[model samples]
Target: MANNNSTDKQGGIKNNNLNKTEEEDEKKKNKKIFIVIGVAVGVVIIIIILILLLFTFCRRGSAGETEATGVEMTEVMEGSEETETLEDTSGASGETSSETEESTEETTAEETTGEEETTETEETTADEEAIAPTITLATYMGPVYSSADGVCYYRVQANVTGTPAPTIVWSRNDGSGLGPNRAQVNLHSPSETYTLTATATNSAGSDTESITLSWGCNRPPTVHEITLMGDHIAGVDYTVSAYATDPDGDTLTYQWSASGGSIANPNINPK
Candidate 1:
């Protein structure tokens, strides 16, 4: 009986040791599973945060790029507008320069024409002045003279020096004018005074001169009779007598001329 009791006690102690080892193994497995679940939850949360940050950054970068593009387009439009304005200003400047040149040319032409006209007028005046005429001399030739039929004749002369020869004209105080060098008059009275005028004329001017003359008739003495103092023969000496008469009673003196003979005193009283 003592041997059987000691064998039963040893079997009980072995079974209790086996049960404690199994419980320790089960506790270790549960601890390990809790730790793995905690680690997985933390990894999932970190991935979600990274995705949200990436999306926000992309949206900000796109907005910055759009603003830069709009600024570049605005600068290009302003540049084009400035270029067009410059072209318009250049065109206006060209037109103004052309107009100025044309105006200057017209002014020069007018001045040249005016100078030509003035020169022509001056030349014409000079020509007219050069062609003017002048008179030199105007006078009478001599005194009046009487003719056989109680007619009178007078002469006048004139001379001129100029571009053209001058014409001479004679005028009498009897209201008669003629173009002759000599003038004729019939005197009804014994004596008459006459005034004669001569005029010298040309293209430029004229000159005049006058002369005075008188015409008259006077009777002359005539011898009536004569008597010789010597004989009619030659070389004979004798006294002589003479008788004389005159239509005009005036003092008388005698002179003798010999043709072919000689005498001592041909003008002695008759005996």
Candidate 2:
């Protein structure tokens, strides 16, 4: 009976030691989990702070650009105001000079005697018999080929008549007057057309006539091939080459365009 009691006591002590070890292991596992959770939370907080800082920096940059643009606009507005003020002052001065000239003319007319007025009336009545001006544009004989200094042009002429020999003026394509009765039009393409105008003015009246001229005398340029060199990447420049020939040996002008992005020089070849 005594031996049995001693064995039972030894077994009880072993069970207590096992239970203490299990509790210690559980505590260590819980501590490890807490450490992992804390690290994850700290990382998340740092990421949020970095994002906020980046956003703030971007906003500041945009605001700075806006301020700079506003400053430029203000400067332009001030310059325009100054220009307007100067123009107003100049216009006022011109009006004053014109008024003074008119006053002087009125005084001179008032000083004229009754006999001079009667003589002026007689001269005006004599001039009233003059006929009105007339303009006649010659039939377009197509574009006349003319080359001077390696430049091609189309020459045109017209006729005018008046009682007192009216002044004649010629204009082409709605541009400024070229001269008396002749005008020149620049040759743009084989299928292009030009409008030539003639105006005659006299004391009696004024007359105008217009004629259309189709240019098909010269051959147009032909484009053979267009090639691109280098990689097409954003923010990087690439070279574009075009092979073209003009049959008439005329000077060729190259114009380039793109659907997107920007070109350094659109008019230059190999852009």
Candidate 3:
């Protein structure tokens, strides 16, 4: 590359002092510019190498400086282009090998700093994932009723489900744990039997479901109809039976009473 040019060439456009055509001059200028850039890259590489070498050999400091100066000269080869783009133009005077060491140190420092920044970025991303939406229980508990006092309250559990579960809120007008599931409906008032409902939620979403219960408590028996065994004999003893029902099956007992009515035969009364 250095051989391509002659000292007598005007403006250093080509090998000879002979005047070239306008096209030829333009092409030559472009070629030189490219060559200058390549040389600049090489100088930069040399600076890096010199810096590494200097770390071990003190004498190489001057060698590194010289390489760096060459890089500066190559850069100046394109100096008239722009000033800001030519930041390291100082390389011309920094020809001492010491400049090479500085270049390498700068690269090392940039690498270290970049690595730490990358690590911090990864940690921050992980933290964001850790704090992802959480499912919270907005409200959860069983509802109670007067009959439920002695029996298990058919608590229709309520909850919220979404990213970040909401807080659970509940109230029982009966001052009992027996409240409607979130809807504030009074259960067990009209419906002798009711199904409990519940909701699950998170900050992002919510879902609901029914809660099951097995109520086995006895309820006051309701008398529906009465039946007699059979037509009774004038003086015979017979049994009169009663039919009753309760939500829960409970054994029933019987007692006989009379009002104005008496035993069919007072004289035949056994007890």
Candidate 4:
């Protein structure tokens, strides 16, 4: 009986150790399952995050394409409006567009081009209008003529054209005229050179020309008989000398000159 009781105690102790080891093994299996589940959850969350980022990128790309297309459409629309120039349908005239009426670059570029052009034209016209009316001098010739006998006097002749018939200004350095073109002077004085300068003037401008008359000479003087020094004596200066009669032929004298230059013999005929 004593042996049987000892054997029974040993068997009980072995059974307790086996049970403890089984419990420990079960706990390890449960912990491995929990770890695997946690790893899977983490992987799934990472995939979801990646998917969300991809979706956001796609939305941004689509938005960019829409914006770019919109801008291009707007530019095309604006360009068409700027380039389209339809003809006007107004009635009442039989006039057509002129070939020379070319549209300027500004016309196509700006909306207010017509007004700007009109303003410019008006200003230009105003500027040109400020200048006064000009007169063309048609005839500025002649030292024209005047002579004194009983009631006659030294005169000048010229044909001038201006707004108003030019007023005559006469200068007589030769005491041959009484009060100038309208006066008479004694041609019987000591030989003297007479100059007749005339200025033709109008309200706008004035011009001058001169001629000389010699008095107290031996014979009838050809007042302005220009002599030739060369072959073509068109506009050349020359020494002048001529004859003048004292009308009564009572011992006459002579004086000759150019504008102011004197002649050699004032009382005799030239050789």
Candidate 5:
């Protein structure tokens, strides 16, 4: 019986040792699982903190850019207002200068117009004064021979001056009619004497001038011969000539009378 009790006690001790070894292995496994969970949680917390810092940095940058843009806009607005104010002031000054220039030009134009009117009035007043007419007679020969009518004539002319234009009238002492400002007398004999008078009349005054004229003797012209040339047929042309001379060295004129046909160039000496 003693030997059997001792074997039983040894068996109990071996079982107790095996149970403690198993319990220690279980505790080791639990500790390994807790360490793995703690490491995973720490990695997740670090990732979340990095994301918050990035978001804060981005917000600060955006705010700074917005403030800089606002400042630039304010500066641009101030510059625009200054430019507009300066332009308005310059425009007002220019208007004032233009008004002054216009006033000066108008005053000068009025003064010039007044001077021209004064000059015209003075000239008109000077023209209103009156002066009497003065008469002057032109010198002429006593007798002159007319070749066209074969007659002798005495002629005189007068010149007159006055403020207004004068009308001249001529008269002869022998009760003969006369031309304007001139007297022409036809002579039938060489012993004739004539008194010529010129009278100038105007609105201002009147004047008279007188002259005396006498005629000298002139000799008559004598014809030497007359000749006719060319065919005397009715439809043909013929030329006629007259040979004549004067004793007093006067120019002689010829006249032709035709009973039939025609005469060409009647005023010429050769016909």
Candidate 6:
């Protein structure tokens, strides 16, 4: 019995030692769980601080860029307004200069027109200052008679008068005249009449007068003699001679007949 009580006390002591070891293991596990929780909390706090700093920096940079852009826009708008004002001033000055030039040209045109009208009036007045004359008679100077040989001699004259003392021109069908005054003529056949015309003229007009003169004759021309140039050779060369006359200075003709050797240039003066 005493040996059994001693074994029971020894078992009681082993149970107390196992109970102490279990209590120590439970305490160590609780401490490890607390350390893990603490480490997780510290890492979360550091990540929150870095995110807040990044957000603040980005907001400040955006604000600075917005201010610089607004200043550039204001400068560009001011330059544009100044350029528009200069252009408006130049346009107004150019219009004023153009209007002045047009007014000067119009005055010059009016002066030129007045001068041309005055010149036309002067020319019309000058045209009214000239005049002409009239011719009254164109006749012979005297009452003429033919001589015994059927010839007559006379002088022709014209009478013309006007304002400005116009000049006279005389023309005859039978003879030539000198100047515009008179003509002297010797009539070969008194039966042949003459027509005399006189004209008077000046700057404004002209006039003409005419007359006819006639006579009677009863004689003809006669052939008298014709003289040759030199002597005659048989078959080489030769000349002839004769004499002819007319009382009224009329023309005459001569005819010849040949019955012997050949005559060269028979119709000529020397044959």
Candidate 6 backbone clash number? 8
Number of clashes recorded per candidate: 6, 0, 46, 13, 0, 8
Q: What's the TM for model 2? A: 0.33
Candidate 3 lDDT tens digits, 81-108: 6664455555564664577789999999
| lDDT string, candidate 5, 135-233, tens digits | 988646446666666556776778778978788877752224554666576655556666777888887779999877665548578888888887678
Candidate 3, which segments miss by more than 4 Å at Cα? 1-98, 125-226, 229-240, 245-271
| Residue 1, model 2, lDDT | 92
Best by TM-score: 6
- Model 2 scores worst on lDDT over the 10 consecutive residues at 143-152
TM-score of each: 0.33, 0.33, 0.27, 0.32, 0.32, 0.35
Give lDDT: candidate 3, residue 10: 44
Off by over 4 Å in 6: 1-108, 145-154, 162-165, 173-179, 184-186, 216-271
Candidate 6 lDDT tens digits, 78-101: 989889877876879888678878
Q: Point out the higher-scoring one by TM-score: 1 or 4.
A: 1
RMSD values for the candidates in order, in angstroms, are 45.6, 34.1, 27.9, 27.4, 32.9, 35.2
RMSD of 2: 34.1
lDDT of 2: 0.78
Query: What are the per-residue Cα lDDT tens digits for candidate 1 across 1-271?
Result: 8888888888888888888988998999989999999899999989999999999999999999999999999999999999997887687998868887999999999999999999999988766654344433333433333445434444444444544455667665322353444444434344666766667676656676666655443334455565565447876764434566543355556555457567568665333
Q: Identify the runs in model 5 with alpha carbons over 4 angstroms from their true place.
A: 1-128, 140-142, 147-150, 172-179, 221-271
Candidate 2 at 145: error in angstroms? 4.2
